[model samples]
Target: MAGLDFLNGELEELKRQGKYRLPSVWESGSGAWMDIGGRRVLQMASNNYLGLTDHPRLKRAAVEATEKYGVGAGSVRTISGTLDIHEQLELELARFKDTEAALVFQSGFTTNQGVFGTLLQEGDVVISDELNHASIIDGIRLTKAARRIYKHKDMDSLEQALRESSGYRTRFVVTDGVFSMDGDIAPLPQIVELAERYDAVVCVDDAHASGVLGRFGKGSTDHFGLHGRVHIQIGTLSKAVGVVGGYAAGSQALKEYLIHKARPFLFSTSQTPAVAAACLEAIRVLQDSPELGERLHASASSFRTRLQADGFDTGVSETPIMPIVIGDSARTMRFSARLLELGVFAPGIVYPTVGEGKGRVRFIVTAMHSDEDLAFARDALLQAGREFGLV
Candidate 1:
């Protein structure tokens, strides 16, 4: 057998550069507080914005579905795996998103692939925000379309991309509704206006925005009141919905088209009965009780305000995901470790995730975090920040 030793050197280099990471082991559910390394820590690193992961209603729904339908779908969705519960969840998702229809995928990353792979083709043009998620980037790469990237949240840059892509078979303007690393919202209204002028399709990946933005957490389209104007909306159940799946919402024709054309949807097994039912219940929970989302925004605003007041450079964050910018990757990793030692679990974000020289710890404040929990995180961050001269 050939000795594969080169990968070891690559990994060692990553460790030396402070970019190597072993994911933290969470021994408990992703609640505001979680068990990590046998210690109960205040969790500020999760995307569970609505804290529905342990909601009694979601739990009950999941149990019931599992009892009735067993544990797995057993085949690809295009085959024998499409359950009635799956269709039901899709209906609820469409209703929540105010779209003509919706189609669920195995995960958010794959949802992007499915959408971009299915929709974009040769002679097409894809205009993407430079800071869009990796999934979006990979999805675009999978196509034969002409790709143009605009500066993050820069409408002028987006217009320039659109202008350059004119006369393509189809033009797309794709952006994240809320940027995950920085927590800043995209300039959607301006993007929409530009897309309209250029006759381009508008696709918003609302993975972080769902259940964290808009009235009743209908997502960025609803937040901007741009209903019926935007073309594609991508959302995730794994984050705020407190389950595991993703969906794309658009016209009924789009859903039907993806059902046939999207490789992920056609190839991957359907979302299990339990997950589908729980997601269906999650939508109901968000729609019926608006307080969940309100609490999330309120907590995020309060925590972000406190962080900013302490002179932390929380660049352009207007949402729950907060990144405390520290330029050096090694120092950023040290800060994150120190925070973990102090019982706050926020992970470091470094190169390849964000650009080199832009290293920070990403903190996600959920609705379930109590005032006391917030204060604990605040003090831990302050102490860590002081040691690193960040605050």
Candidate 2:
């Protein structure tokens, strides 16, 4: 009871910092337009970049797989639950990524944990970008590896860290392919150069980049034309793939190592058969069509360009994710609430998600949105932003 009491104190501090958040329950299908609880809203807060969550092909694949393999994988993958659909998904992902091999995990967060938790050792070193995901930070902690955080996307800082870590038994340089909050891509070509100069293993978490960047959505490696240079490539099925799971694409040896030693993968039950089938179908769709990603980026550029002309602070965003910086968390949250009431569901990213005094309402543009949707969103945004004094 005494230990549990600490939660109240922590939550109170979070509230004081304006970092406390409670998301609206999204009950209906997630797409360009979604039903939040019972109200319909134009979606902008999701990571579903391609708007494939409710696609017909994915739906049909899920239904068919369910009819064939039932609802669940009966046990953990290492036990007796590695279904044919699971293997098929892995193979397809490998092909999609143009990697030597691929291994699926239950979620992107877990995929990070699995990779760092298994491949790294106590004396190994982790050189990470300061703005890497929480999953990467937690994964490093799980490995008990020494970590050095470089300034976000600063190659000079990364090279310094790598130089300092030269004497370590093994070194890993990790970064998110895209910074989720800023929507700017990591300087991966520079990172690859630094890693090679220091002989460090490079790992890129492509959660936000997968199915949203590169030719046919092959993610950051393909986006930068650094296909075989990087060592570990991680991705998600939940975001652009519009399904639910994660994966790591690397050498066949890396897959074998993870299969044997990754505790999360070995201990947790595998993803459902239908999820595997749905994810595979999602990959196929992405491979067959490049127009969706192109259109999504174009929409994002138009919105950002328009917002900037209206005197809104749209920070360094180069992708479909656009953030309207407001500097005050309470005001950002207020802007978000008013916008939601006005029929858009773009959410606030406050301290901890961003930093103190740099709060914003982050928008994720998708391909499925029509011209009417964009026009409506522009008007809603202008009115709400003006009301909140953010514009």
> TM-score, each model?
0.99, 0.97
Off by over 4 Å in 1: 1-3
* Model 2: per-residue Cα lDDT over 1-391, one tens digit each: 8879989999998788667787678878777788876888998888878888888999999999999999999999988899999999999999889888999999999999999999889889999899899999898889778889999888888888988987899999999998899899999999998889888999999999999889988999999999899899999999999999999999999999999999889999999999999999999999877889888888888888988898888899988888888888888888888999999988888887788899999988888888788888889999987787666
- Best candidate (score: lDDT): 1
User: Which tens-of-lDDT digit does each residue in 1-391 have in candidate 1?
Assistant: 2488888999999999988998788899888889977899999988888889999999999999999999999999989999999999999899999999999999999999999998999999999999999999999999999999999888888888888887899999999999999999998899999999999999999999999889898899999999999999999999999999899999999999999999999888888899999999999999888988888889989999999999999998999999999989998899899999999988999999999999989999888999999999999988988888877
Q: Scored by CA lDDT, what does every candidate get?
A: 0.93, 0.90
lDDT of 2 at 288: 78
Q: Which model scores highest in TM-score?
A: 1
